[model samples]
Target chain A: MIRNEKKWLEARLEEWVGERLIAGDQAEAIRVYQGEKPERQWLSFFGLLVGVGALSVGIGTILVVSYNWERIPPVLRQLGFLLALAGVAEGMARSAGNRIAGPALGVIWVLLPLAGIGLWGQVYQLSGDAFTPLAVTLMLALPVVWIGRHASAAAAHALVFVWTIFVGVLEPGSWISMRGADALRTSWLAVVAVVLWAAMLHQTRRLSGPAVTLLLWMAFLVFMFTIAGNWTGFDIRHEGIHFVVAGALTMIFWVGEGVLGLSGRRVADVGWFATACFLYVLSFFHHGVGIGGGLETAGLYYAAVLSVAGVVCLARADMDEVAGAGGPHVARVLLALPWILSALLLGGDRHEAVGYLANFVLVVFCLYTMHSAVLRADRRRVNAAVFVLGLLMLTRIMDYFGSLLTSGSAFLVLGFLFLAMAYGLNRGRRHVLEQVERGGEA
Target chain B: MSGKWLRLTLVAQIIFFVAWAGVEEYGRANAVEFLLETRPVDPRDLLSGHYMTLRYTSLDPEGSVEGVRAAVRLEFEKEVTVDGRTWPVWHAVEKVEPGRVGDRSLSSTGGWADATVTGSRLDFGIDRFYFSEARKEELNSLRGGSFYVLATLGGDGTLRVKDLVWDREPPTP
Candidate 1:
């Protein structure tokens, strides 16, 4: 345990730093590391790709068969395969990054990026929902970021992100049903969102920013649809203004980066982080006061402005000395006071703000926070908080949509589809391993 | 496996388990799934707790009907085929044998009705089984027919639907 480092425990890191440091023949060292043949490791990568591909197929079959997708278009099935392949490619690419597949990065990159982009364009085009705008931005940005990290994984992550976005956001309508008054009370979407939050936390989870952006947009879709029809609908009149303002601020952040010569991705990162926070705090404020003050109020506007500013600063610079572990935790702090006041001030009074539009926005804000929190990984409370919020939203959705919906059958089918997938995935993996072991012994 | 590897796998397993368990438990406890099924009931007679929902075998895409007339004609090329249309599902034809499929039924939830079905062709059930009484009536008019439609176990473990049937079949008595 003490020997985890190369030298003694008390060895000066600076004293040995130069040995591996780039002082001597940096070019030759790069060349040698790059030149080493990675054929053996290539075989291991192929094995991983095979495992993931087979598992995905086996799992997909169980779901499609159990659901009887006689009516589902084949294009969707093709879309699913594209996603699975991307995941496999990402794993292979990550392996390649450690100098594993010497020359084959050439071959892998060619096939992987093409498949990845093709899938991305198709899936995004297929849905074209409110969330589509957000997902497309992230998907396009990711492969570039992945290429920076490792070309293969980036391609794969980008590809997988596209499909997950398509599946989670675009396809098969949401089972979420919430009354106008209790829209934030509890909805099935909230439940699924919470579960997804938890699942992300427990896995060695990574959020391809685009993937999280897509999901956040998905949560936001409920609001978009709720007040979608009329100019006077609660979401359109109230929260939509705020989202537009946030979008403007995001664009400003983009413009600022171009003008001031600042970082692009970080600017985008901070903008997303800030938008999520503003939504979080707004949820609390509206929750406290059934009907919040208009955007004309200086105090609310100042807080909003500062929240965006703080995230921008944090995203641009290392905020470790100032805020430590950065945007998510700070966002939580800013939101905590309002949440407390909301509960204490409102108690359990049932009222209407043009039918609880304000509260629904807050619900969306909280869901977004939980999503961002999972990506940042250290903040565990946000995950729990979102799950509870989701449970609450389910009640509202069912109450509102219950009368309007055909039956609870859609929700039931969704429930079964997920259950079967989980059961099948685990079983299928074990079965594959057993077959492998028997073959190895042979 | 290494300790780290085992821990990671265990965590994944826990996450997957919790997700499925949440969906299943929530569905059963809340009757969320039951509320989602397609329940057929007359709009005039429909209410939350009243009226057994009816689903027709002739209407369902995947159904198996037993003991019908042998030569009951087949037409597969049209969409939205229901009663009283010029080419309705069943007319005055030589009675034929049963078909190989049965229409499945589930409980209904409230909403504006989308489409309407008129005149019965073939219906299936266990206790509510009517072998063509050659009479027709509105489903809601049946006495004591107001009840929540629920699933029941047949002789085997397969599903059996029991509710109300408004139209009478001819071969009964």
Candidate 2:
């Protein structure tokens, strides 16, 4: 059973015992029959240890090959790698029913192809970009990932797959060159394509949970960096259109969760968190600080299409149904507000106004997240909201006292304020959680 | 996945690696050898470790070639002694139409190389020559010296680097 189902059953058992609908012993029996919480913790630790060991051995082998040991003949090195690969494959095949050994061997099995390719390049003195070998390795490893169905191997495959896409996109004279505004736009489009591909893989169950999670997290970090880049004056030419694309991408997770049923509650939570972060970062931009290049007609058209699609998706995704609460309509409004306001303010050349509007909307959204998290007893979301609040406080404090006090004094004051705020927030969080637990018991 | 299917996939993977290595080995064995004068552009690839980036003197654009794609026909100039090994040096003759190099007259059958014209430079894609880290300092000292790459031109227009000879000194194997 899924974790949610298990938690629901446990909660029901507690309520039944509280109401005397079932005895405490019966409740304990049901809990015991549930098989000790799936043993995921032990498995996760074991997987980590195995993953680290595999990585060390793989890197050591690659380094040995890279050393270009002149004493060993090239043919001998090639033969050794091929034999190692065969041995690993044989082990993986034989350990079919052993969970720990099977996945561990599968990790080695998937990595050997890349190492072999690297050795091949080394032995042949083949001089080319890393993209070719990486692409080839991913192709060769796909079958292993599919047939082995090992999460660790799948995670390794996903990492290399994402790396290959990045290398292909960013490498000079490949699919796209990493120069100028056009390159930036194309790179963002590639990221969007990969994220959509991952979602498709998840929907089809071809990618396991860990692999999909890693892909999504990497994509999220990339998105955050892009937004942070714009805020720091990297100056992407079509500023308005960039915002639209980002907003549309953020809306995709919500669409996946509500409309397509391709993602789960974690994905929806990510969507909300990303939207909050997108607005929070955009609030830092000052007037006349962005790209001054005239907007291209093609960019405007792209922006228009994206805006329409984003609106349609948001409208189709019932916020309350997806959030399992009543206040998510406010979240939906907050989501659309950025795209609309960005177009208006940026088109009017009132870029500073965007900062003001984003600040307001972000504060309101953080409060909403905090309230909703407390109601649902979601410590993660509550922590996220508190962190955002702390960031806001720091930004304001820096802005107000940056030039007024001496540098050392300002840092000292900031340090004390941070400690005090953290202490208060921790106590408040603990009190709220205690109340939640008491309510549950009662 | 069942053990039977797992075995099948593993076997397929082994076959793929073998075939890949075999094809590369065959290409190297059958390819025609020639030397091209080159200069070091950079060193090292992040993934593959230490290496040298080479730009072929014959394929340099020199602000003459126009358009995005250009095919350059090569003609063997003369035999030169590099590191006590005699290798035929090839130079670019003239720009010819793509896939029509054979019809145009050429001094020697050193094969043609396709290059991507980016601004005033052409990327022949056979530019990198990977070497061991022990030879890095030795190769770095010959950056501005005479450098010739002993390469093979495959029948299908693929060029592969076989060795790097610097200032008529044999490179470490």
Candidate 3:
């Protein structure tokens, strides 16, 4: 693709020179401007593979060592681990700024602390809970994260945090386990807030690339855990508190990052806030629709919350003046529109029809998403939009025609509908792309 | 960190870890050991790799009561055993929420204190027994027996599970 671009520019420059629109030297300068080498994505790709491979091997080694600790003699086992740690650490240090450093550091980043835990557990006969070792290991891994600033090190730190929480929750004797579920839920929210805050701080400080990457992943994981945990419908009353907290954090980060003109982080913040808001709106509708009931107080709350979200999204999309008419606003509206329509449709006591209305809204929303994707000339987004549209269709078919699975006519109808939609969407896509090309030409 | 600083940090980490493990071992060696009868509640912590769940009768401070309190404060009173040796034991139990549990540093280096049990359970913290993954099945089979958790109660109310004993024998290695 890059080579094609360079060739096209060279041809254009030649044409300009031929037309006497510019001097020969000017054309040469224009050619030179387009000649710089693009980034080597293969380096990054190899680094990722190496990182994953190292993690797998290191973890496998630990498990192997753990199962055979007694037969190897404590002294030999300890010496082996120490040697491994030292060798990896030294190699990682020497390989700094090299392609292999990312993976090598990842090996030590995970191994050293975990080896400490296993060593202490084996030597001290510390039983009943693994919390102490896990916590200590996590504490030890922090320096590696801060100093190494490699993706693997940051990933190891994030995994350690998750593992510590997992160990705490599993061991009833641990502090987190004894604190009860309410406290755990609250702590997850706290985790999200802290991580998000750290991410913003890292962005503001212009920290190392790996440090920034780590924070983003950490924040994303915590946010997902919080959302999934609450959505499981365990202790429904407490669910409200989680939604409120997550919603607030999302909005706060979104507005703050957006206003600061951190465009890269701003997009992520918007995504997080919009998803959270959508979930919050869904919470109100779930109970109403679950019981095959009408919109009660939950429906009203859903409308109010979604209305606020729609306003925010619309306003942000509007503020993006550079993208012209159908930019991010179309995407935001595509997200916010269905829920708004669903809320309005559920405003009446047509309780049984709520599911059908939701399905209708989803199908329409998906179609619009596909249309917007085509118009924006985003082939990836267009593909994704079509994929989601197909999924929604499959869901509808299954929901409405499950008993008709043995009927030939039902299968034929489903097949026909699928083909028709596929054909129409493809034609629409081609037309949109041609229009975009024509617009570019003009 | 640069090469020199990274090496220094590595050395520091090793020293810190050695000190932590050494101090913990010294504390355990000096701790007062008690043989508490334990009932095996479960066999393993599958998610956490290798472990055994242990339940002690003394873990319940409420003694089958229904009402839930905010917190329970426990203090040890010196008792003379049949052998005429003074031992610290939970003698006076006070359930308080308003203003009972406070920082009363009990011993040298503040190693001991009146332990507070959050909610109803008196968690002495020795609730799991670790083992190798290969021994999970072997250790799990030992759950259906009369066993005891030989624990060491540190002066600071810290409870450490020293060993899991069954049929008068501890597991090999």
Candidate 4:
């Protein structure tokens, strides 16, 4: 058992004993049994220290090699690098049984090859485009990451992967530079993000703790970028298709937790938050939405296929498993509402009506989120709900009074409303939290 | 992972690096030498450390062919000498018509190499010549001044920079 699991079990056991649901002796026995079992530490201090030391050594080595001392022949320098890599590999192999030193050596094992690739570019006076070499280095590092089974090595791998993609995008003659490839480029990035998330889902079955956390965070960051791209209007010609891809990605997050056993509360939270935020942005579009006319027929077909897949996944999923509360049927409807509204906007010309409907859905979703957060005693979600509501009120107030009143009066009204809302929300949040705490105690 | 698999992975990584270096070395050893006139476009690439981005005057096409991909023939006009080294300088030839052309050799007739015509630019993949940190300022100062690049074209049409010959003596590090 992990520390958190043990703590929860202990609390449950005390509650059961107090209610006479179980005898005190039985509770004591359960406690003793759990106490005797070995506790799994999520992170080892010694392992962290070793990992940091290894990173330092790796950076120091790269610095020394990159100095490009005139006296040392390029061939000799490369040979030195090969030797160092071999030594690190040997150390890693020998320390396989050591949980701390093995992964530490693995970090060096992964990094030396990348540094060596950079050194090769420097020595050969190769093109400054780092994409090819960085891509090659990442390919080589994958096996090391899988075999090392350490969070530090996995994190390093992910960092290099992201860097490689970044460099590739910026390289001359890439897809980004080519005309009419904007939608394709955005789609490719979205696909890459999905692949990372799929990898994270796979990792959950085999590993836990920081490795999974790092992967989740990296995947989520990329996913968020794709969502942000929809509004930033990078490719206006394919705006509708971008929304389809974003909607599909959001559905994957929702379905992954509810059906695919993605082991974290944050995945579901991310799904809800992204859906709510996207709808909230759409609500501001009072005029007709300007989805471009150059919609690819192929993209529409893809969107149809994705919509079918999403519906199937949602039908198979139990939202209660994700939401951790009853009334999962209602939760499913609420989650589907935004995507449905988005599709309506895409397929029809009634943009203003759909925009108004989106505003209504956003408010309802925020209220639902607050209720769920209170039920789960999640203070963070309650605060998030309050923040979103406050933003909505502020935007609406600015819209109503911007031209109706003088600048000074408008400022005074906005300031007063802001302060009043902040005070009211704070009090409401505190009362809800107090009720939740009391319920838990009871 | 099993010890056997881990050792195999380690060996494979070493082989990957060795193979890359070995391929470049082979290309360098067998490549035929040529001279090309280049002007520095960008002084440095921060991502790949210090390197001078070179724009080949010969490879710049006359009209816009943005986003067009085709195989291009390189034609050499004359021999140029810089600091006592003489070699043929490449000139821009017409892009190869894929099916209409009968012979592949016609595309690479007497000149050094072939390059992919991508977008509006001809990519030799050797456009950037890396320099040491001490020579950064010297290279930056060579902007707008033509320099001779001693490049080699391998059998596979890959071009590698062998050396850079400046019109005047470069400053000592």
Candidate 5:
């Protein structure tokens, strides 16, 4: 069940208690009754352990078979693979009703199909176009994914998406001259296609939040990695195709979220906003400050164009949020401010000034995220914000210590600071919750 | 008992695995063996696992070849002496530039006849050799010099490396 649905139910129950329609004890009983029923609670803990143990054993057996593959006769080798595949299939069938073991076996079973593909590829000496085997494996494992609707199925699906992206980006081909730029474009579009499918599945209640979230994040990272590789000089002249495709995807997803009236739209919005700002900052570092180097005019022009696209996406997403929430979102405004500042500072001669401003914006954005998460009672959001803040702090400290760390004392200071940050984050979570409860806002 | 469809799917998966493996094994069992000259690549990688990065000089297509599939036939000498032993020698028969193949001359079989030229190498499919990890050191020591890959070549141009040969002999098991 979605967290929002659970919260809405709790609030209605609280209202019933306030109205005194029934005794408080009755309300409490209802709350307890409405709690999420564990799917086969008895099979949870111990079954999970057994399932994991089975997976480990399966892995060991496969490894042993593969290791002694050459020693076995060719026909026996084929027999061994068939036997192992059947063994896993039987295990999966037996545990079909088991919540823990079913998924575990499903996940373990995915490897068998992949192993079969690799085994045959080895035997027949298939060509090294990595995508072919992966595609074949995906086809082979489709039944497992279809029948096993659990974490294992989700993982198998994720592997397919990841492998597809990997093949698109790194597959050796004549497009090698593009150094994956061509492939990156194709892969990013593939991500968009998958995400759209996931979104539709989610709307139909066939896909889980974790699955959709994983797809969205993977899509974002795949695009980001492509751009990040050539951030200083991502030539839109030759390589702008992927950025345009990514930008279109970002807009489509944002619009689709609004049209579908889906929850967790903020994840996509924030991801796009963050990616935009990242590109803008990288551009400013190259075009504005020219720190560590500068880009040619064409590169700068491409960066400027991408930044505009980012602004458009952020504005549309923010407007949608405001329209729904009945007010301007402070977090959205803060996230947008950095891009504005970077745009203004673009081509400026002030390197130190822009650098400091970008750092300040990063810290503020992190705090805003953490503070809003507290007000909203979202622990995952809070953790994500804290992680970003911690990462930025570590990077900044490391940069300073790069030249200053000549002795053990500097290392000691760094270690102590890391521990202190951890402790502070724990305390800060409590303090933020208490402050929000006291009607305070960050 | 499990859901019938789930059970059916499992059985289907098993059948698929068996059929796939059976076909591959059949091909390998019937394939004719060919040898390709190989050289050591990356000392660190050679020692890292049972697998070694392999390169075949013949597979590296020289000049330009144009076509979705680069077609080259293997020219085999009936017999040749290697060291003190007589063995069959087979190598990819790459015509430096097939004039008729490039210039509007079409073959009914759609063979290498109408193929253009480019620099991309033919994927001989023998780029890697895998063995048991226990023999990591043994494989690593072979990095000392050039070696020959005794591989099976299928009718449809599939290549599988079967054994590594040094000094015109397969390394002792």
Candidate 6:
């Protein structure tokens, strides 16, 4: 979901809740975190870690006393001590909110799963039997999911999304025709896509903006699917239309919720609806090539201009007001641009039309998003960076290898694309901040 | 069991077997071997990473009597056959023999296969044999061989191997 929409949803939820009582805005956690929070409301979360670390240390001490410390693996002993420090840090971070750099610690949270993997690996270190990594990862990630739910953020959510696929969903216990790594990568990507959409879905119920931000992700996935067409049987006419339809329906679902007032939660209902409609229109356009070429052309042309504009408007949208309202306006505009443009591009002989347009637009959108985030001093700009990079990688699908898949021209074009985007983001941030400081109602 | 019950049970058993077989076959990633008879001098996507967008000679959706090889001839009304019963597909030994050098993989009658398939290879670049990874293992068990694009669209399919090269052989350096 886009930063603005997330803000909009929170603002609206705040207003709605404030209508009845006082509302807290710790990065507007309720609007974003809802069911995402962990079940443990108790502060023992850190205590549990500390306790586990202490138990490990005590066990290690006894083992050392029972035999010689030198006989045991030094790595195991070092790990126990490190675990102790991790517990201390975690405990400290939770207690004093002043010292806790909440959002500043994203990768640490993501790598938390590796700790579990490590523990299991250590346990099964002997006799060459290593079957516990997956188990440990899942176990470790379970609490992390709870932690993410408690401490709502994009990074936290992305971490959980990664963990869930690796631990909860995919099967590695059995020997399949494909290797575990292949399954892991493929399923991991798919799970991330679904989780992102789910975030969109959750956000859409309140306001449309965040859901609209998710459309870029959808575009990214589409690009990946198309480029990775070798691994997939994702013929647009056959299977891809289903995803497009589902995406559209998802948008519509949010819109319907908002219209019914059931979505009193802060969501960009209108933005979500618009994004879905755009996806629906895009599906029609791509499929239109062999099926409805004329309608597809017209639809894509309309969508491209509108969606790109929507993202720009939303990224710059003021959210301190009725945050819910901000995202829908921007989302509607953003969804229209690419889908409509794609229709036009598809109609012509533009090679890698989706890549050129989507990549260009994504870079522009990323810069704009980062600029808005920086101007607002919102931490979402970090997420905007990741999202932009993701879109950039997805665009590589358009570049041919060796020749069709390895076009050197594409790499140069993309390399500059990133550099240019970085430049633009920096420049735009200055411009927006300057404008804001000049008393413009940014 | 009564006659009707027996018949119903028999039908159910038949359906169960067919469904089981169908799923097992479809779920499996099929490994087929192909060998090129005519080596195009120009490197056809030698370093193509990931999926090289493939074009098949038998992709003439319109029923054309043209020969299957990209550049070859087939005598008109040449009856090619697969004794599926006497020689099931497992027994079918396919290799790009000298005479078979430009013969496209085709049945007595030509058509397209319904299965979606992928290829695997052993050697690097041009010297690589294009077969599914599973099929490559199958080849390891057999003698050293070449690669081919399977001409498929039938009860089973046929292999048309070409572009023979060895792993130790250098490219046109």
Q: For residues A263-341, could you state the per-residue lDDT of candidate 2 as single tens digits?
A: 4565656667667767876777653456345565455665567678878888777565324235667667776776665
Instruction: List model 1 lDDT by residue over A397-440, tens digit each.
Output: 54555444333455444444444554454344334434433443
TM-score of chain A of each: 0.26, 0.52, 0.43, 0.49, 0.47, 0.40
Candidate ranking under DockQ, highest first, comes to 2, 4, 5, 3, 1, 6
Task: Compose the digit string of candidate 5's lDDT tens values, residues A330-350.
Answer: 544654564455444444365
Q: Write down the TM-score for model 2.
A: 0.57
> What DockQ does each prediction reach against the true complex?
0.04, 0.30, 0.19, 0.25, 0.25, 0.02
Worst 10 contiguous positions by lDDT, candidate 5 chain A: A174-183
Q: Ten-residue segment with the worst summed lDDT in candidate 2 chain A?
A: A175-184
Show model 2 residue runs off by greater than 4 Å. Answer: A1-23, A26-72, A95-115, A127-138, A149-244, A262-264, A269-294, A304-442, B60-72, B78-87, B98-124, B137-143, B168-173
List TM-scores for all candidates, in order.
0.25, 0.57, 0.52, 0.53, 0.57, 0.34
Worst 10 residues of 3 chain A by lDDT: A233-242
Would you give me the overall lDDT of model 5? 0.55
Q: Which portions of model 6 miss their true places by more than 4 Å?
A: A1-100, A114-138, A147-149, A153-237, A246-266, A269-333, A338-351, A363-424, A439-442, B1-173
Tens digits of per-residue lDDT for model 3 on A1-442?
2423645777888888999999999987766665555523422557656755665566557656656655676557556666666776677677777867656675475558677666666555555456767777767766666666666566556656656665665454455552342234446745654564465345323423432343444345444544344334322232332333333334334334445455643444344334433433442342254322333334235435645764574455432311334666654554454344444443454434544555555555545544554455444444544565566656556556754543344445655565566556656655655554454446
Worst 10 residues of 1 chain A by lDDT: A1-10
Taken over the whole model, the C-alpha lDDT of each candidate is: 0.36, 0.66, 0.52, 0.65, 0.55, 0.37
Per DockQ, the best of the predicted structures is 2
lDDT of 4 by residue, A198-286 (tens): 67445533533432453455345444444444324443344566566556555655656534455556566666666776788778766
Task: Give fnat of each prediction, in order.
Answer: 0.00, 0.50, 0.28, 0.36, 0.34, 0.00
Query: 3 or 6: which has the higher lDDT?
Result: 3
Better of 2 and 6 by lDDT: 2
Instruction: List, residue by residue over B29-78, the lDDT tens digit for candidate 1.
Output: 43211111223544322111122334433323333223322222222222
